[model samples]
Target: MAFVYDLCVVGAGMTGAAAAREASIIDNYKVCLVGPAEPKVRKVNTGKEVFGAHYDEARIASSTSSKVPVWGILAERSIRRYSELEHLSGVHFYDSVGSLTVGTRNSEYLNKVEKQANSQGYAHSMDILDSQQLRRKYPFFNFSSEDQGIAEENTAGIINPRKMVMAQISVASKNGCDVIRETVTGIVRQPDGNSRVVTENGRLIMTRKVLLATNVFTEIHNLLGDIRPLYVPMPQTVTLAEISPQDATRLRNMPSLKYRGYGEPSWPSDYLRNNNDQIDFYMLPPVRYPDGKYYIKLGHSDDILKGPLQVSEMQKWYCGEGDKALEEQMFRLLQRLLPGVTFLSHHGDACITMVTPNSQPYVDLVTPTVGVVMGDNGWAAKSSDEIGRIAARMIVQSDWSYDLPKHMFKLYTNVTGPPPASKL
Candidate 1:
């Protein structure tokens, strides 16, 4: 029988969905997305897919444990991509305000951040701020001169993440790609080299090419080890705290920041993002809490994310319940940061990010029958949409060229040959 589709993308997160949506723009090729059964099914029995929970202190600890340079660089790349993608996806990201850093005089990580910004050709706006200068600019900080600070003006801001993912999926589907909401059970290659995706319902679909944008779970099967893919799944946590419209405005106006950490402060960097009436204080590194447990509720806490910081180490935590625990930590952290705000409802979300060893993404074809775009380390604010468009071009075009920088394809290998000669 003829192949069922030109491409099959596993995972419904930003990467997989982006690949599928963009593929439809090609001439007459049929593309299909074989992903989880449901992207947002909140069944108590069904566990978290890509994201899990946000723990304030644990993540800060996690950040300090490994190479801080990697994280800072990824964040910088994300900042640059924001402007380039806004017009293409019609997604609005708030890139107006600068990010403030409030830490100690000898803060190690923040200085590295400056170096990263400089190396990436983005050091133009970073301003070193003393406590007095910070106070003069925004009195809300409530921090003193004992802290060393820097602000990257017009560098970083927030985007409506879930909404942007949906927009890409919408446009890609409208272009004629078939998006299937199903969990993949296994993958097998036929004699002709086409891939067969076995779904949870036992339905099998065949395709000429395959792309694995599965994020965290991508490593669970042949897609990673056999493919020798350069990716890691790390669980990250962010909190959603409900605030009065007035309180929310305070956070909205305030530039988000990373703080000068306390002991083991490495894992619990304070991140400031906002929901309508609430401020989201996300933490990483999954640390150990005061009670000496992995997670807890309503108490002095310090818990670590039980996973690896590098692609070398990764573990999954069902985030639905952990989300509650993470929210509690974020709220407590927020209370310490901004005492005046009160909360209504609090929730946590786990964002599993695919990270490459070098911190850049993998966007190239590794096999004759497969090409992929994966690994962003959760800096999807701009990279996701742009990467999707890039993946779309690589997968759908006859020439395998659609404006991707030449270096992007060279990342996976040194093979300097012409594009695949086989016709689609």
Candidate 2:
């Protein structure tokens, strides 16, 4: 008898890996995951190549959010499960040194974050700190008198995102998931209603259902038909600053920090402070890099690299170091936050993040046999597990499960209600 995969997940990044792994938990169906071995070489929009978002070295994981209430809940659930997942997978990726969101006193953004935490029933996990307290607790940080801190009490820090994806895929493979490391060329529907997944090397894999977690490439393949129009791809960059091991120790206990800023604008456009005036900065504690030297990582809180791009443009951005001006600004921002620390050298990587019309991700069943988990809005690293869980539940069961607030993540419902007040 020929082997037919019960579920075939394309794009084994964070979301695909998690979805495949979660779905594999059920012993009833044979699952398979397909993705590119090297994402940078993958062809995307306009038939050109671009780098994958998960190719980054690290990503921040925290429960604090100034967006919708459900965002925090999803993040909190995933954050709490990091340890258990690490133990089960025998892979250590989560570095739980804690996290902090620092903003000017009376800042509207900070107020919203507090409200979000309260609504999610995890307010106890957060603590407010005045400028004096912030300086006293984290001496390595340089905070202004007007700044205050929202300190997350537990399960917040930097995560090795690539390794986390590997861990998920590893665990899923061990759970009997067939791992296919290849690019999906096309997905065609069969006469009997099943889907046939075609790979780059002219191979056909039959699957009962298909989950497209291919991120921005969803558009490249037109996976969702009309629904695919809802996602927009934007370039994202992160810079790493090499520092001495002594400086790393000095800032070792420093929590993952988000520096919030507000400009003359009466209103903020996007959630992550992605504006010319309201540009925000985020930092992760120093970690040893491949060169055996400790390096601190930083990136803009704003989706500063806005607008759509062709595959060729994205490929150029990924294969090369990011914008020099942005890197300079990032360095200045970091130096301002920690004046005592000195960066010996700087390096960074560029990738793409798919944004929805709303900031929420699309983790819903597009058709009876087609489910999608895309448009992470740059939050996939921390929340991929929950997003994957929702997708897996959809693939396993005929209806939505009560384990998560599935309705909030529905793509069609979100786009029809109202356009996002601001660009994501």
Candidate 3:
């Protein structure tokens, strides 16, 4: 017997999972989710590929954006819907520990963050804290006297990204989505105008429409043939520090912290090759990992370089051993900032995310039969739910009546040259 679906969503990461789940809400449509299993090391190759993006335990979910107003709007929508999503999906994912965006007074980043909050009418969701107020609330931070912060009391916190994705896909499955754990190797358009997705094991899934939420892998695999590159895949490294129960208790009340680094330049251009000083970093509160140890996660915003870092394949870049000197620099900063905080050693891992020129995601139809929800730019977790909802509605309704502005996410085809031969 042949298999067919009304919609097929590729990539089971945050966007794909949520899209599949959202599309399956209606009983009339048949939706199938085609994605790869987690990538792993092996002596021989299997068809399965790991989604390195969502492998982490915690991701910052905040409505307060230091970058753009649209992001804050998207984040606020997603954060507001999280509870409803959890209730409907019957899976818990948000932590609601609150979050802080700390920066020096008159800092460019903080200015943008405050502007977004005020412009988006979400200023009530956060409290702007002067350096003294910030110190009073969170004394652990070693902020300069001129530092200021924004406290998202309820609308921000750390999220279990893996569980969030699982809950979404699980809900999709319950809602009648055909969940296939196989990888889609190729997509071909049929004479009848339907799209046929071919799996590595020779299984075929025919569908009227397709949503590619493959994130960095979208570019890595060139899944949309001849579709101009909408995003560039870049490698990001995260450092993890296993903490003791006592340390966790001490830091239990600490919100997820986004510090722009007060006294030094932490941006990518500051220290691309050198790692002697700490770069700007986002710090998550201690969360229990699969190993049963509580660990705090920190990731640097400084690009591995100032420009986009190209990744050729998904399997080639999964592990993030980290730059030792950089890790040491981070450790030094943590010690100076949070005195007496215990660390049970540390390690690093790398993940890839699609970064657009403007640091926004693309949520437009690439081809008539294909739509995309890629280019997360590292904010996919908090924005996944809303992004998925938008992508699904665009495909199913075939209309643009979304509540959020749809102009920024329109597809841009900049394929100036010939397409690469077969691989990303």
lDDT of 1: 0.53
Encode model 3's per-residue lDDT on 1-424: one tens digit a residue: 4666899999888889989989999878999998875654421154345454787789999987766466777888888888877887788889889999987788777888888788888788788888789889997777778778889986688888888988898889889898888777888899988898988789988899999887766654457876766566666767788889888988888899887744432223433332433346788989988878998887777444333555544454564354566665565566555666878888776677777766777888766668988878888789889889999989887767787667677665575332243312
Residue 41, candidate 2: Cα error in Å is: 9.3
lDDT of 2: 0.76
All models, RMSD in angstroms: 9.4, 4.2, 4.5
Q: Tell me the tens digit of each residue's lDDT in model 2 across 52-147.
A: 677756677888888655667777888878887888799999888888998878889899988888877878878899989988998878777778
Which rank order by lDDT, best down to worst?
Answer: 2, 3, 1
- What candidate 1 gets wrong by more than 4 Å, as runs, is 1-3, 37-41, 44-97, 219-234, 260-304, 308-316, 323-330, 345-347, 351-360, 376-382, 389-424
Model 3: ten consecutive residues of lowest lDDT = 265-274
lDDT of each: 0.53, 0.76, 0.76
Q: Candidate 3: deviation at residue 376, Å? A: 0.8
Clashes of 1: 34
Clashes of each: 34, 0, 4
lDDT for predicted candidate 3 compared with the true structure: 0.76
